[model samples]
Target: MKSLLLSVSITASLLLSPLVSAKDITPIQKKQLTEISGLLRDNPELINPLHSNLKQYLDGQKSLETILKTNHDYLYNNPQQPYFGAENPKLTIINFTDYNCPYCKRLESGLVGVIKKYPEIRVVNVLLPFQQRMIPGLKTNTAWYALNVWENDHSKFAEVHRLMMAKPSRHDSSSIMKIAELTKTQKDLTPNQKKMALVEKNEQIFSQLGLRGTPSLIIGNEIIPGFIPQEDLEKMIAKQL
Candidate 1:
């Protein structure tokens, strides 16, 4: 009986581990476990298998928690990235996007609405520019140049960003030059190696975060991949909060 009780307790602890600290089990799960404990006391033979299953569940939960926390911290405090929103925000959403992605363009309105609705939401935009690879002969230089322009003159970054977002289909050098001229964004005649390095770093970060596409948002510990409606976005934020 004592051994059976130990197994039951171990199983209960694993099930409840993700949602609370080891020292603090919630009342509902505690109550439910207590009831299960009484029944499990008669079935001592089941303890070993149940213990193994419980260990697996706890291990998976720990892995996921570690990932979320690591990602959140990486996105939140990375001084090298560009983000615009709440100052000293309570909620940070890391946004991976490409200027040439239509889905990212589509998501812009809803993302803007989220920031307006929640004064504490910070949207960190990480330029993955994977779309550049699709264009024949382009070496993903647009985003690299954009980042360079942003560093040179932050006050003009928004105008440059808007132009790039507006002209996703245009891959012609002249068209890019036109947009750059309009925003006074083309400072370097050649590919600025440092900015391209930053882009590479961001791409590595995107891959490390297990993202395959654009318009992926990291809200709290959760990653909302692809285009999501404003209502769904709100619900996700509410859940995290």
Candidate 2:
């Protein structure tokens, strides 16, 4: 059996899918191609004439790669939302994180620690929160509350992210205010009554994306679900780097 825990620990040790490299395919694409080729070669029943099919797939891949490489700018040419590393916009990582969720916080720290060690990497923070009816319009209404609290400030989001993973929340509004103060949240918007509608809209978008968990990440065209360790993330990041 595949070690589910090991996979989660490694994957959640942190994240994956693709990298924004100027040349070559992303890590996720490379891994996918490798797996597909392996299965095709190994399984006679799956591909009785594996060699013929493999060449065909490779040819198709090359054509697709060429087309994408030439047209990528037009394909994804939107002013992307940015976060922590916006000032240093080298290679960007878009993270949909929740502070209330423990795993999301864990992965956030691992990545942050990586950033501290390597300041060149740029990470964007998208405030995808997990919320509720009581705090109805905070953001996403899922288990992860920290992300909700984070909407008031991105840096606070990062701070609370680190705290929630290593320690339990007092699990109250006070915790929100405390983190807001500690992290110097921008505008004190957390206490604003009028921002509810905006928060609801944000939550709506999170739901629309079909995400049901904390830390649903987007790196280039790659969509990664859940938290992973730094080592796994580094393996993915190496391609872009």
| Candidate 1, 94-135: lDDT as tens digits | 888888788998887788898888878888888866876433
Candidate 2: minimum summed lDDT over ten consecutive residues — where?
9-18
TM-score of model 1 vs. true structure: 0.70
Q: Which stretches of candidate 1 lie over 4 Å from their true place?
A: 1-74, 134-140, 168-171
The residue-by-residue lDDT of candidate 2 on 121-156, one tens digit each, is 777555544632333334323223443345545445
lDDT of 1: 0.73
TM-score for each candidate, following the candidate numbering: 0.70, 0.53
Which pairs of residues clash in candidate 1, taking residues 3 or more apart in a chain or in different chains?
A: none
Best by TM-score: 1
